[model samples]
Target: MTTTVLQNIRPWGAESVDLSIEDGLVTGLAPHRPGSAVPGGTEVLDGGGLLALPGLINSHAHVDKSWWGKPWVSYGGEATTQGRIAHERTERSALGIPSTDSTELVMKEFLRHGTTATRTHVDVDLGVGLDGIASVRAAAERLGGALEVEIVAFPQDGVMRRPGVLELLDRAAQEGATSIGGLDPAGIDRDPVAQLDGLVQIAVDRGVELDIHLHDGNDLGIFQIELLIERTVQAELQGRVNVSHGFALGDVQGARQEELVAALGEAGISWTSVAPPGRGRLPWASMREHGVRLGLGTDGIRDLWSPYGDGDMLRIALGFARVHGLRHDAELAAAVQLTTTDSAPFVHRDQHELAPGSRADVVLLEAENVQDALLRTPRRELVLAGGRVVVEGGELTL
Candidate 1:
């Protein structure tokens, strides 16, 4: 068995600790000892007094359509959501963006920035077929030990409106998709019941999970969420479901928001936020209090939706905290948790704890403490997964 020691590190930026890893799991964690003796055949990763934190997990992202490391493309389509999708499809097709190359670029970028795992939503339609799924899978296989990627067979266009998309989604699931994805039901499908029914059926049949995109605002969005809650309860898919971008939560009043938060928690449905400004703000604090599974993500990276997103969860989490006015140390620390501890389980059901006997998937930041890590957004000096170093000196080794 291989053994490694992460010496002179501060976990969550508090108290200097030394972590001993054996067989990819943390075997011991205690206060650092000065001039500790080096055991033979054991590797030592000098933390240099850096802060250690669990690797970030981006719970919702689109890796197949990122334009990162590519030329700029301005959005010239109508401002509507469907219009943007049409334009993006056209542009991606015109560019003939190969999945093997683009997906690798994006995933590698994610790895370089301390993300050890991610749940990427790949488009599945008659037009795209399973190209996105295949590409993401290939990328994951190539980097076998570096990072974990969960592909959600997503129907970007309405599942019902697309005619035969549900069948396509099922095929994608059979082809190794870990989750089933749904688009706006009331906003795009125009039928919440049918869409939710189709999605839940696929999930239950294939033993997969559900991640739906809900962009409808106010009553319509709330209606769709209620439908999801009803179906989730009926199907008994509480812990296996998630609603992405439930913007309606931002428009509701205090009591109504509390009601929705409580319902979501009781149902065990998770929520993923890209932390968009204005109408995209969610009751994250209340949801956390209610025991809701909340995770942060970078929705789309320079895609047709907007020219933002760089696959940087730390930057996104920082902005998420600032947008919510999280100025206190503990509050800021919680923001950091959104990308790490709070989001890891949502991305991969297997718990990734920064404790003894837990997988050593961690990032050593060049900072004084946890708050300093977030405030300064320090560069990662080292990143490890399962006792193996995937990144060293802020560069990818695998």
Candidate 2:
């Protein structure tokens, strides 16, 4: 067993400690000792008293379609979702959207920002079929396990509007996608019941998780959310269903909002948000009070749809904090947690932290505490993904 000891690092800004790793999992942690001796053949790295955080988790990403590492493509898509969808379909093929090289570049950007794991949505439509998924898998393999990516077979285009998409999603599930994704049932498909029912049936049949993107706002969006809650309970998919960008939750007010939040908790449905500015702030306090899980993400950085984001989860967390008006230290720290330990379930990890028995996915930064790190977004000094040094001194070593 190859062993590595990271000496003199502060986990979550706590006292300095030496963290030991063996075969990619944290084996032990001891109080930092300057001259501690190790067995022969053990690799040692000095941490320089940097604040250590568990590698950031990107709960929602579109890794397959990012335009990173390519020449700057001017954004020409309409601001609407459907417009963006059409624009991408019209232009993606010429740009090679799902090639392994481009996907690898996106993964490298994530690693450089200390993101060791992600639950990325790969477009699974008629145009690309399963090629996007294959490309993402190949990219991850090329990285040699430096990043853990859970796949979601996403119907980026409307599912019901286009035939064969349901079958594609089904095939993706059978071929080892951890989850199948859906788009706005009412807005995009115009058949909320049929769309939700179809996706839910696939989830029940394939035994895979379901993650639906809901961008429709107001009553239409709320109506579909209710349908999802009903079906999730009926299908016994509690804890296996997620709503990405369910903006309706933020558009409602008063008792109706309270009821929906409560129902979501009881049904075990979680939510993931990119925290886009100018949108309503999520009722995070109520969501927390009712046991609802929330995960943060950097959605589609430098994609054709929008020219924003750099795949940095810290900046995303800071945006979330600023959008939610978080002022207290604990609140800011919790925001940081949204991108790290609290996001483990988003990527299907039972535990993701700097403690023993967790994967040795650690990020060391020059910050005094978690809040400071979130606010300032410092460059990572060292990043160890699965016990392998992938980044050092703010640069990718892999």
Candidate 3:
């Protein structure tokens, strides 16, 4: 029954308030009273009139495969998906891709950037088996709950193309992975139906969620997306299915795109994007109007695939706003929401915000408002995860 009081903070740049926490959950809030007295034996942290936000949530990430803290690894792989996959398989072993130490480093970087929760896709292929999952679990455990991680047992290598990968995915689901992941069914496997069928069957059988990567663009990507919608409804997975990087949704035009968006909404399928540059802009407005969920992620930072990213969800949110041509203050605020409150489902939270009954995961920054925070991407002055101060003054404490 430990209690902590965060004094003089503006939640989402609202009027100042004093937020109360007990036993790792937000308990109460009241208008800030300057020079207020506190009960004896209760811990107190002065927020210094900083703007507060719920700790950022990363909807998509690859924590298991990042080479974040090590010396710079030059990008030698081709810019294509298959090329990156092949290069990772060849180079990961030498770099100890799935080691607990490296995963911890990545998680620390995520924390330093104010992200407190993530849905990370750990590689689960014929080569790594479930070692990556184990490593990520160990790393999260070592952090003592400062960072909440939802594991997606990802088949970085194609599933059907490599024999026994589906079995491994099933085993991972059986072992309690929140979701099982698939990669480029049409583009990489070249057998979209078999791949989708296999992944959906596993999801249905194991009662775990399905999240598939769809990099094939235009008609090819649209074909696989339609297959996913049909399978999601057929399997009764509904909100349990997600599409990552569904580029085709943006490639199509006019009525055809509207039809697909409507189908996605009705099917209850959600989407996650890293918001990479040069790709077609997602039909985000239509998706929102259709009630489809969109979450932002950092993908894999400093991984074999790319030598970019610093685990900053704010930067990713800004990129998403820029890519979508968001200009209004409301739109900019919405971009920030995509990384926080709006992304609750991505990490399986019923509610994630600076409000009562939510987990006491708060990030404080020096900013005028939500829009200001999104634009400048200022340093997090303090971060509280589950009532514990994991970071203070832009540095990790644990």
Best candidate according to lDDT: 2
List runs of model 3 lying over 4 Å from the truth: none
Model 3's alpha-carbon lDDT is: 0.94
Q: Across residues 1-398, which tens digit of lDDT does each residue of candidate 2 receive?
A: 98999999999999999999999999999999889798889999999999999999999999988888899999997889999999999999889888899999999999999999999999999989999999999999999989999999999998999999999999999999999999999999999999989999999999999999999999999999999999999999999999999999999999999999999999999999999997748999999999899999888978878889898999999999999999999999999999999999999889999988899999999999998898899999999999999999999999
Lowest lDDT 10-residue stretch of candidate 2 = 276-285
The true-versus-predicted C-alpha distance at residue 327 of model 2, in Å, is 1.0
* Candidate 2 or 1, higher TM-score: 2
Under the 3 Å rule for N, CA and C atoms, how many clashes does model 2 have?
0
lDDT winner between candidates 2 and 3: 2
Clashes of each: 1, 0, 0
Lowest summed lDDT window (length 10), candidate 1? 93-102
TM-score of each: 0.96, 0.99, 0.99
Model 1: residues with Cα > 4 Å off, grouped in runs: none
Candidate 3 weakest ten by summed lDDT:
277-286
User: Global lDDT for candidate 2?
Assistant: 0.94
